[model samples]
Target: MENVTLSEIKRTPELLKQVESVPFKLEKGKRYLFVGCGSSYNLGYIAAEMLNKNGYEADVVTGGKIVALGDFPEADVAFFISRTGESTETVLAAKALKKRGIYTISIVCAKDAELSKTCEENIELPFADEESVVMTGSFSTILYMILRGIKRYSIDGIEGFLGKSFEYVDRLELKKFSHFVFLGFDELYGLAKESALKVQEMALQWVEFHEPLDYRHGPKATLTEKTLVVMYSKDTAYEVELAKELKQMGAGVVYIGKEGDIEIPYQDGFETPVRILPVQYLAYKKAVSLGLNPDKPKNLTKSVKL
Candidate 1:
């Protein structure tokens, strides 16, 4: 399991190159609905926020919501994303949307999988397929590929950023923190959610996620020496102040932004994919600290059949 997860992580840069060649195109001025389950849904949320910012109308919905309640939103086209392509809920959602006459697109890591077969259009990412229960590189790879298809996103200094991220991650005392909080907004909010999931899935740790300023509303009461607050900052003054206050209050804080721990450039949400590395490393390290195998993760399967 360790090899599976780490293998995917180490191959991300090369995976991005392969994902860029995926044959898919977005029509300008057309509304899009993105549906998926779990991490895939979070990626859709990030994509919706980004596309909306760039003058496109995009809405995100989870496949579970669609399957359980028929809560699909209105849009000119619907895109379904599933890493394994066999997720029942996602495939069902795509089939239902297509039946309603909405043009449907499927993005999966496997070619000729059930989900892809159910859609009118399929953007299969065979190269980004993973064997681990949790997603490491595929999440970032798929997101980057979709973004590149919309407008080229260059990860020019990815190697340097990754090295710095690991350095910061290694220095963190993982077992000291009993709780974790991830803060961000918009696209970063989706990223924050995904980061929290990684820690939960990989380390079985108590994790929370929220918009930066919103963290103070009620969640701040939980802060302590045992809590780790990871701020995916937008380089805003208020967030910097919040991070300072959290640090003074005894919580371990790792701020990711320009001049922060991870020090990623705030480029209109273009750096969202890079923001994931530090937290991913933290999860892996925390799992190891607890003497748990991150690869197997309690009771998880590579793909949810039902």
Candidate 2:
């Protein structure tokens, strides 16, 4: 029932400094492909969005999609992200890209893993590796590394944020909520998606993710006392109002903004990774409350070999 995921989450700020000096070279003016599964795929989605928005050309695709349907974007280089580096689809996808003369790079938490061995080059962050079936700190660490490599972001003061998020979660009773919904826009939308996955993976909770205003369209029909809607606000007036409105409607709301529940300073999109910390803590706490083991979720493995 014990695992390194919790320890790794607590060590995020220290982990960031360890990889800060790594010579990661993401060439500009070239098309790049980012591929992975689950949290890894979501990180790729965020990275690709950030890179494309900041003077680079990048595309994101899932390893399963590439393996099952052979649908992948053409690119000069492919970066395969896998925490365990042994996911069958990711390793197979790397092999497929390398066969096409595309430069392949593996970003993994462990060295000499199948995906790393299959790719032409690799960047391994063994310090970020996890012992749990679910991803926590490794998700943020690899994401920070990718964003830093692309020269789109640099992070600071996250150590304080890490402590604050843990404290916030410690004070709350997470068992009250039976369902979780996360909302954001653009890069935050990617984060919203990741947040939903975190609860679903670590807590086995019902979860949904959507764009901010879109929830009012049809998703609001499901609002109830058992639901907790988390708004990763851009600090816009409309987003702020929506959080207030949701709270009034009986659904518990967690508004994360410059001055909200979690009190995160919005820095363009750089805060996106850190914005996930509270939700990660929330999920873990919720799992513990439900008498479930966050480290070993049912019906899941550390790596999806098939």
Top candidate, metric lDDT: 1
lDDT of 2 by residue, 200-304 (tens): 988888999999999999999999999899999989999988898999999988888898878898887776767888888888888878888888888999999
- Per-residue CA lDDT of model 1 for 31-144, tens digit only, reads 899999989999999999998988888999999898899878898899899998999989999988898889998888887999888898888888988888898899998888
TM-score to native of every candidate shown: 0.97, 0.96
Tell me how many residue pairs clash in candidate 1. 0
Q: After superposition, how far is residue 264 of candidate 1 from its true place, in Å?
A: 0.6
Clashing pairs in 2: none
Clashes of each: 0, 0
Q: How high is the lDDT of residue 39 in model 1?
A: 96
Q: For candidate 2, report its TM-score.
A: 0.96
Model 2, 177: alpha-carbon shift in Å? 0.6
